[model samples]
Each structure stands twice: as C-alpha cells, then as structure tokens.
Target chain A: MRFRTRRGIEVVAVADLSLDVADREFISIVGPSGCGKSTLLRVVAGLVRPTTGDVRLDGRRVEGPGADRGMVFQSYTLFPWLTVQGNVEFGLRIKGMAATERTRLAQDYIEMIGLRDFANHYPKELSGGMMQRVAIARALANDPEVLLMDEPFGALDAQTRIIMQELLVNLWQRTPKTIVFVTHDIDEALFLSDRVYIMTARPGQIKQVLNVALPRPRSLEVTTSPVFVDLKRTVLSSIREESLKAISLTGTE
Target chain B: MAESNTLRPIYRLGDDLRPHEPIPRSHYLIIAAASTLSLLALWAGLSYTGIVQPTYFLPTPGQVLATASRMLLDGTLAVNAWASIFVIVTGWAVATVMAVPLGILMGSFKFFEALFEPVVNFVRYLPVSAMIPLLILYIGLGVEEKVAVIFIGTFFQLILLVADVAAHVPKDLLDSAYTLGASRRRVVTRVLIPATLPGVMDNLRITIGWAWTYLIVAELVAADKGLGIMILESQRGLRTDRIFVGLVTIGLLGFCSDYIFKMVHRVALPWSPRIR
Candidate 1:
C-alpha cells in the first residue's frame, strides 16, 4: 500500500517516447527546461537504465556504457591530468591498443581538430572553447558508430559556440556517423540536425519532428537565411507551449 | 597629514583588494616582509628591554639564538631533531600505506564507506593526546609508543580526507570514461586514481604537517630523546632559552619539509589546476 502511494505521487520525466535514427543520420531533441530531453539522451547512451524499455545498437541491446557509442557532455569532461593527445588516445588505450598505433591515430584527430600544437598542453591550461574541442576530438578518435552529444556547447560563449558548430558540421560532413544531439536552443538544433524532435512537457513525448533541409558544407550564415528562420519560428512556438505547461505543472508540485 | 593623491596603484588598497583581484607579487613580498619585521621588532623590545619582567620565561631573541648555535655546535640539537623526524617519517609512511587503500575503497563503494566512515568519524574526535596514557600502558614508552601516537593522530584524519578527495571525482568524468569503453577496473585505475591523485597529494601534504605536531605530543612523556622531550626538560630547569631553541628547530624542520612537498607537487603534477 505504501509502495503504491509513493508510485502514485512520483513525477514521470519521460514516457511513451520512442525514437529512431537512420545510419549516419544527425537528429536533435529539443524541448522546454523540464521536458526530460537530456534524460532521453542518457537513455540512449545507456548511462541510465530505462524503466521498461531497451536501447538497441546495431541489433545488440545496450545494457550499459560501451565503446560503440561515444558521449560528449555539456561540461568539458576531458581528463584534466591527461594531455590533448593522451585524452584522444584514452579509449584506444583502454582496449589495450599498442602505444605506437594509438599515438599516431590520436595525433591524426588532434591535427584534424586544429590542436596539434597543443597536443601536450593540459586541459587546465586551455580555454573553455579549446577544452570542448579536445572533448570532441577525444570522443571522435574512438571512431564510434554513433556520437551522443548533450548540449556539448552549452557552456561556451556565443561566438565560440558558433565556431564550434561550424567545426562539428565540417567534421560531420567529412566523416558521416549517426549523431543524436540534445539542446533546448532551437537555432542550435535547426543548424546541426537533419531531423529535430520537439518534445512536450513532463512525461515527455515527441510533439513534432522538423526536417532541416539546409545545404551541407554549412556556414554560420545559414542561421540568418529565411528557411532557417521559418524552422526556428515553428520550433519556438512548439517549445513555448511546452514551457507554459512545465511552468504550470511546477506551480502545483 | 593627508595621503598623497598620486600614490602608486599598489598603495591604492581601496581598489587593489577588490575580491579576486591580486596585487603585484613583488609588492606582496615587500608588504609581507614589512609585516614580519615589525612583529620581530615588537618582540625584541618586549623581551630585550625586560618590559614583561620575566627573562627566564620570555627570553630575548638574541639569547634564544645564542642557545640555538650552542646546541647546534654540541650536536644535541641534531640528535633530538633526528629522533623526532624519524618517528614522524615512519609513522606517516605506515599510516599512508594503510589509509590510502582503505580510503580509495571507502570512496569507491558504499559498502566500504559504511564499514569505515562511522568508526573513523567517532575515533577522529577522540583526541590522540588523551589516548597517550592508554597507548603508553599498552605499547610501553619506546619508539613504538611514539610512532603509534603519530599514526593514530594522522591515520583517521588522513583516511577521511583521502576518501573525500576520491569521492568528489566528478560523476561526468567517470561517465565519460565509461562511454569511452573503460571497464569497472579501468574506471578505478585510469579515471578515479589519476583524477584523485592531485587531491591525494594535497591531503598528504596537509596530513604530514599535522603529523609533525603529533610528534611533539607523542614525545611529551617518558621520552629520553626528541625535541619535544628537550622542551619538557627545559621547562623543569626553567631554561626557556633552550626551550625556545627546540621550538625554533622544530619550526625550521616543518617549514623545510612543507617547502620540499610543495616543490615535489609542482614537478610531479604540473597539470594540477591548483598549481597553475
């Protein structure tokens, strides 16, 4: 009886939320503050266990965190003790890859990220933007099938975030992989995602899916275009409805 | 007289000391030196001019310096200083060996934390000085007793501090490591250890300083050697100057060890944000 009472009062974060991505597809989840978008991403990353469902990757169920899916967090999670090259080599080293091979491979990613000169510099010495760039490089070096990014540029200032977005788009174009990006920012989602899943308020379900038809080899200037503006307006209206619902729900709780 | 309107920026404290803003290093050094020199002058006047009128209890700075040199020449200072240093090093080493693993275990798992934290929290408050009588009765008054006192003094505190350092390794760090294919064991070795090593070094530095103080307390009763006993004997004969000498020697030793630890930290963990 006590258990049942607790269950009755429990706040559901996300429910009835099913999603899919094609191979090499780039999708984004956008919603209001408490709509459980990050929770949705965590569910996919296998960092959190879903109450009554499973996450399958290439037909194999993801029971826990693994090398096949790389995660980039909002906070720069690069190991402070490791250098840029060392950080990029982390996953390969864990797999017991030989030092010589991992070093060369890590160096390639470092060069691609424009951090070859700072390969030996510690994370503490780098600026926030540079640190986030290293985090991106570290995850991509493993060559995971899918990359899960949870508002990875949320901490960066506007200009740095724009530059990081361009860098990511260029990298994605060069080496296509399935990407699931989570952010509340409409423009960020519209700019990078092939498909955007706008979620409803608490007990989150998909409200709408917007297909971004923007051209590839995309620059920061695309955000100013009319097509991008229309998509942003649509996403903003959907997100505003969810935000109001979330606010009213909070007042009661 | 009014202060100069065109004073140097360093002298304009109203703006210079606003929260996180720091003064120039050279200016800081000069101010620190001036502060210490002024305090030394105050002490000199109070003792040398007999202002307090208790020369035996409050020896002049010159008198204490004379005793220091005399003791150094006779090698008595060196012998007792060495004795205290030995206990501190041995006891600290033993405690570190035991505490580090236990700390990591307690920090890593809830089971180990449940096993250790309550007992440690209870015992840490039971002062080591108060336990000296029991320690003396059980261990007898020898090197073992002194070392035990220092161990007891440091281990409980060290374990808790080390555990805290380990526990506070950010969740995202371990999360990122896991997603990058680190196994459970790999998380401990690669993520947890390196992430907590800098903090553990800081904890060691802090605990070693406390261990120095414990050595004096350990040597307080029935000890024939150590600077603590020298002070104890000096009190018996009212040789405050010699007591002052012993205190100065202990202070010097502590200062040197702390400086060495700092230098080692800088060299070993240059990546530490605290150092940067």
Candidate 2:
C-alpha cells in the first residue's frame, strides 16, 4: 500500500502481496530492511487498515484491532509504568475478566516465561530479553488465536536474541498457537518457523515460500544443520538480489 | 552490543543512570540534611559578620529564630501559614480538577487539540503576575480573588504541561492497547492515564511551587491573613527578622509539600526513578 511522506512523496510500502496463513501454523516473514514484513503483520493484527484490499480472518474481513490477534513490536513496548504482572494481565483486564481470574491466568504465563520471581517487578527493571518475554506473555494471556510479532527480538543483543528464539520455539511447541513472526534475520526464520516467507524490499512482495522441513522441537542446533544452512543460503541470496533491486530502483546507494 | 560480553563485572550498585537500582534512602537523607545545614551555616555566618548590615538587610539567624518563636507563640504564624496553605491547596486542587480532564481531551482528540491548543498556548504565555490587577478588579481582593489568582497561575500552564505529556504517550503502547481489545475509553484510562501519571505528578509538584511564587504576587494587592501579607506588614515596620521568619516559613512549607509530593510520587508510580 502507498503512504505519503510528510513531504508528500508517495512511498509504496507493500503491493500485490497475498498469502494465506494456516491455522495453528508458525509462519515467519523474512526480508531485507524496509521490506513490508511488519506492515503485513500489522495488517493481520488489524492495526492499520489496508487502503484498498481487505484482510480476512476466519472468512470475516479484518476491520480493526480486536481481541483475537495480539502483537508484540520490535521495541520493548511493555508499559514502563506497570509491573510485569500488570503488563501481562493488561489484555485480560481489558477483556473485563475478574481480578482474581486474570491474576491467576497472568501468573501462569509469567511462570511459563520463567519470570515468576520478577512478576511484581516493573518493565524498566528487567533486561531486554526479560521484557520481551513479558511482552510475549502479555500477548498470550488474552489467549488470542494468532500472535503477531514484528522483530520482537530485534533490539536484544545477539545472545539474548538466540535465547528468546529458543524460548519462543519451546512455547510454540507446547501451545502451538498460530504465530506470524516477522524478522530480517534469515537464521532466526529458519530456526523457528514451520514455513518461511521471503519478501522483496520496498513495495514488498513474497518472493518465495520455503517450508522448513526441520524436525519438531527445534533448537539452536538447527541453525548449524546442513539442511538449515542450505535453506539459509537460498533465503539470503534471494533477499540480497531483492535488496540490490530496491537500491537500484531508489537510486540512492 | 558485543562489548557487554567482555568478562567485566556488571556492578548492580545503585547509581543515577539506573533507576531500577536506586541509591539507598539513608544516603539520600544524609545528602539532604547536609545541604540544608550548609545553607543555614552560610546564612548564619554572613549575618554574624554583619556582611550586609545584619540588623537591617540580613537579620541574624538567632533574631529570625526569636521572631519565628514569637509569631508561633502569639498564633499569628499558624493563622497566616494555614491561610496560605489553604489557598495554595484549594487553588492547586481546583486547577488539577479542571486541567486534567481538559488536557486529556486535548491530548487524546485532534479536534479538541486543534480547537484549544492555540488558545491555551496564548494564555499560558501571559504571565499570571501581569493579571493580578485585572483579577483584583474582577474579584475584588478577597480570599476568592487570591485563590483565583493562584488557580490562574497554575491552570493554564498545567493544561499545556499535561497535554504535552499525554500527547507523548508512546504510539506503540497505544497501538498495543488497541490490539488488546481496549475501547477508546479504556485506552485512555488503562494505558494513557497510567503511562502519563508519573509525569503528571511531577508537573503538579512543579506547578504547586509556581503557585507559591504567585502567592506573594497574589497577596500584593489583596487583603491580610497570609504569609505574604505578614511579610508585607513586616516590611512596612522594617522588621527584617520578621521578614526573614516569613520567608523561612514559606520556604519550609514549600520544602514540606515537596517532600509530600515525592512521597506521593513514590507510592503512585513505583516504576519511576526514586529519590537518591
């Protein structure tokens, strides 16, 4: 979709992009910088309405943000004012669940994220990985049908990012909630996703959909596997080609 | 990012940069006491040496203390302090009651913001001291007039402060709130209000200090029975010690209220940076 800059220049963020996300499937969208992976996730999350086309969830047109889809942004977006428990319980609280019930539910997710000790701690008090874990728990506490994460580990240091990816994979294994994970890291996409969608830069479109045939219960070890390495090479080359095309089109590099 | 991986020990010792690990409370108390005592010592030294004609310009600390005791014993200090506190609290409360909602509305809705931003901006720049004569003309130099003056001094500035704070509520936070199935009202209440509250408390604390600034201004053309009036009366009699008492009284009161505000902020916003 085209967006006008403050200077009124038309920038097409995404165009001619169409894909069906399967129920209970873990899908990752990987692309170069400025690709519309995040925008696509936002569309499904019903945050920004598409200018022309419609996003359908369960055969119903996505109208606006709803309880069924939850999103975690790249930044540590946990409300800095709230304790970890408070942040986790935010969605359940908004859903009008009774205090005791929401508290009980939020505690479970907090425990799942292995932050039960820090449940009463504020977001500012936690490290980036810990904060992102809370963000994940917060999203899942509402029991949404789909979790839309936009490079949620992008801000974390490399070690933290790997740990977060493993944690996410473990969580998905246990709950198997439908997840639309968007990232620029091809290794991350290969390590965690059931299927990886590679998109072109700028007016982003899905260039390829590579189904990761790696075994279940994937770990950090998967990234070093020959199969994972081959998939990564293919994904990396496609992304590099598209990035070069984008640079040529924009004529600024 | 990789630099953090060096085996350098990560010190968890509380410092200014890390709000999560605040410096201990006793240390803060020590610092505060030391600063207060040092200032008092400086004043006492200057007066004892007759640096600026102690009897006329700067009263000796002992003489000021004697005057304070006299006022306290005669109950004049209590009456005037209470009156000033009453006006300040009432005027500040009134300003908060009105400014918070209006500011939130202006911050939340573009239409209200567009409608009120220019007007509020225009009025906020107009000094409250400049409006004293006009306020007296309109309200006639009564207690109501003083309260009105304090309110006017605080309200417009608070509105703008609150609006700016509310406007800056993180966009990611608001979007997350929306995706959580929060209605517009809940987004304002649950997210925006809570997120902006620490800043609001800080702003209110500052504005209350500003109210004290306009206290003397408010009393300049007004009736009696306030600390400002007490200072004015003392000035007429050339009672430098009494003037010092009044000044000290206002300062002490402001310090007490600031401490209370800090306490309230601590209780209300546990996530915020604490006293160090």
Candidate 3:
C-alpha cells in the first residue's frame, strides 16, 4: 500500500505482499533506518491508515485503536506519574474493569515479569531493562491477540539488550502471542524471529523473507551454532546489497 | 613496632572527632535568643545616641513593635490582614479556575492555540496596574473592583505558563496512551494533566507572589480596611511606626505564603525535581 504524508512525501511501504502471519508467529521485519518497518507495524496496529491497502485481523478490517493489539515502544513509554502497578492497570481501567480485578490482573502480569517487588516504584527509579519489562507487562496485561513491539530493546546497552532479548524469548515461548517486531539489528532479528523479512531501504519493499529453521525454546547459545551463523551471513549479505543499491540511487555513498 | 609510634599521633587526632548529628531543638532556641539580643542591642545603641530619627523618618524599633502590639490588641490588625488574605484568595482562586482549563485547551488544540495565543500575548504584555482606572470606572470602588484588579493581573500570567507547559508534553507519551486505547479525554486527564502538573505548580508559586503585589494595588483603590489601606492612612497622618508595621506585615505575609506554597508543592509532587 502507498501512503502519502502531510508533507507530500510518499511512503510506498508494503507492496504486493501475501504472507499470512499465523495465530502466534513471532515475525521480525528488519531493514536499515527509515525503511518504514515501524510504520508497517503501526499500520497493523491501526494507528496510521494506508492509502490503498487493507489490514484485517480474522477477516475484519481494523479501524482506529482497539484493545486487541498491544504495542511496546523502544522508549520505555511508561507514564512517569504512575507506579508500575498503576501503568499496568491503565488499559484495564479504560475497559471499565473493576478495581479489584484490575489490581489482580496487573499483579499477575507484574509478577510474570518478575517485578512484584517493584510494583509500587515509579518508572524513573527503574533501569532501562526493568522499565521495558514494565512496558511489556503493561501491553500483555490487556490480553491482546497481537503484540506489536517497535525496537523495544534498541536503547539498552549490549548486556542489558541481550538479557531483555532472552526474557522476551522466554515470555513468547510461554504465552505465544503473535508478535511483529521491528528492528534494525540483524542479529536481534535472526535470534528471536520465526521468520525474518528484510526490506529495501527508503520506499521500503519486502526484499526477502527467510525462515529461521532454528529449534524452538532458543537460547543465547544458539547464536554460535553453524546454522544460525549461516542464516546471519545470508541476512547480512541481503541487507548490505539493499543498502548498496540505495546508495547508488541516491549518489551519497 | 617503630612505625606504630608515628601512627599514634594521627590516630589520636582522629579519635577526638565526633560523628555529625542533627542540631537539637535547644540549639534553635539559643540561636533565636542570640538574634533577638543582637537586634535589641543595635536598636538600643541607635536610639540612645540619636543616630537616627525616632518618630518622623525612621521610627525606633521599639515604637514599631509597640504600635503592632496595640493594633493586635484592638483587633484591627487581624481584621485588616484577614481582609487582604480574603481578597487575595478569592481573586487567586477565580483566576486559577479560569486559567487552568483554558490553558489546557489552548495548549492541546492547535486551532485554539493559534486563535487565542496572540491575543493573550498582546494583553499579557500590558501592565496590569495600567488597568486600575478602567477597572474602577467599570466596577466602582468596591470589593468587586479589587477582585477584578487581582484577577486580571494573575490570570494572564498563569495562562501563558500553563499553556506552555501543556504544549511541551512529549508526543511519545501521548501516542503511547492513545495506542493503549485511551480516548482523547482520557489522554488529557490521565497523561496531559499529570504531565503538566509540575509546571502548573511552578506557575502557581509565581502567581501567588504576583497576587500579593496585586492585592496591595487592589487595596490602594479607595479601600479603608486592609494592610495597604493602613499603610496609606499612616503615611497620610505621618504615623511612621504604623507604616513600618504595615510594611513589615506585608513582607512577612508574602514570605510565609511563598514558603507555604513551596512546602505544599514539594509534598504534592514528591517525584518532581528537588528544588535547591
């Protein structure tokens, strides 16, 4: 679908793609910066409407924001004024859920993310990893069918990023919600996704979709495996080729 | 064993040092006593030698204190102070009630901001004291006129401050709330209001001081029952002691009110950045 911004710039993001994401597929869409992967996820979340395409979940056209899709942002977008528990209860409160039920639900998810001791703490008191966990817990507490994460761990240091990546993999393994993660990290895409879709830079189009044949319940150790290395090399080469093509067209390499 | 002898001097010097502890209440009493004594000594020295005029230009500190006590006994000081406080509070409350919602609206909506901001900026730059004659002509020399004076002065300042604060709420926070299924009203109340509260509190703290300045001006307009009226009356009669009393009372009240607002702000927004 093609979308034009208010600035008269055209965004031809998803063009003629016919891939069905199953009920709980963890798909990652990777490209260089400004490739509209985040925009595509936002479109799926119904935040921005496509000019000439349809986004449907279970054959129903998505309209406006709904409770069925939960989004976690890269910036750890927890309301600073609210305690961790309060932030998690925010979505439930909007649904007119009772206080006791909301508290119970928030507590369950807060505990699930191993933040029970820090439930009363505000977001500023948390480290980056803890804040992102709170953001994840907040998104999940609403019990959405699809979880949309836009570079959720892009801001953390390498060590914390690895830890959060593992935590996310564990969470997905246990709960198994359909996740569409957008990232510029090649290793991150290969490490966590069932299938990785690489896109061309700018006016982004899906260039290649590679299925990672890695076994489920993947661990950090799998990154060193020969198969994982081969997949990484292939994805890297595809992304490099696309970037080189972009440079040639723009003449700014 | 020979090196131990040299270390003994350092250890002895450190051993006499005591751990720091909070000052005891008795220490406050001693400090207060010392301050009063120093002030009394200075005043007595100035009065005995006639270094300054005692009655006309500079009243003796004793005379000012005596006048203040006499006014307190006659119940006039309390009444006047209360009247001034009532005017300030009513005017400030009305101004806040009008300013906050309007500011939030103008801050959130682009069209409203564009329409009202220029007008607000224009009117805000006009000296609030310049409107006194117009206010008196319109509302007469009554409590209503004084209130109008105070409201005009306080409202414009608060609106600009609150609107600026509201305009700066991070777009990511708004987007996050919206994506979480928050309606527009919900986003305003839950996210926008809370995010802008610290800034609003800061404006309130400033506006309270402005309210005091306006209260004095408001009382200067044909009123006979406030601290400002007392000062004017004393100046007319050349009662310098009573004038000093009024000035001291105004200064103390302004200081106390600002301090009280600071305390309340700190308590209300505990997570806000600590004030120095």
Interface RMSD, every prediction, one decimal place: 0.6, 1.3, 1.5
If chain B of candidate 2 is superposed on the true chain B, what is its TM-score? 0.84
C-alpha lDDT values of all predictions: 0.89, 0.87, 0.85
DockQ of each: 0.88, 0.63, 0.49
lDDT ranking, best first:
1, 2, 3
Per-residue lDDT tens digits for candidate 1, residues A42-98, read 888888888777888888888998989999999879998899899999999998999
Superposed model 2: Cα runs more than 4 Å off: A80-82, A97-104, A248-253, B1-42, B51-55, B271-276
Clash-forming residue pairs, model 3: none
Badly placed stretches (over 4 Å) of model 3 are A1-20, A240-253, B1-74, B233-244, B266-276
lDDT of 2 by residue, A59-178 (tens): 988899998998999987898878999999888987789999999999999999999899999887889899999999999888889899999999999999988999998888877789
Instruction: Note the residue pairs that clash in candidate 1.
Output: none
Tens digits of per-residue lDDT, candidate 2, B1-276, equal 788779755653345357666676776797789998999999899989887764488888899888889889999999999999999999999999999888878887899999999999899888887888888789787898889989999999999888888898888999998888898788888888887787788899999998998888777875679999888988888998888898889999999999999999888677874422
Residue-level lDDT of model 1, residues B43-159, one tens digit each, is 899998887866776899999988889998999999999999999989998999999889988987889999998999999999899999999899898899999999999999999
Report lDDT (Cα) of residue A160, candidate 3: 90
RMSD of 3: 5.9
DockQ for candidate 1, please give it: 0.88
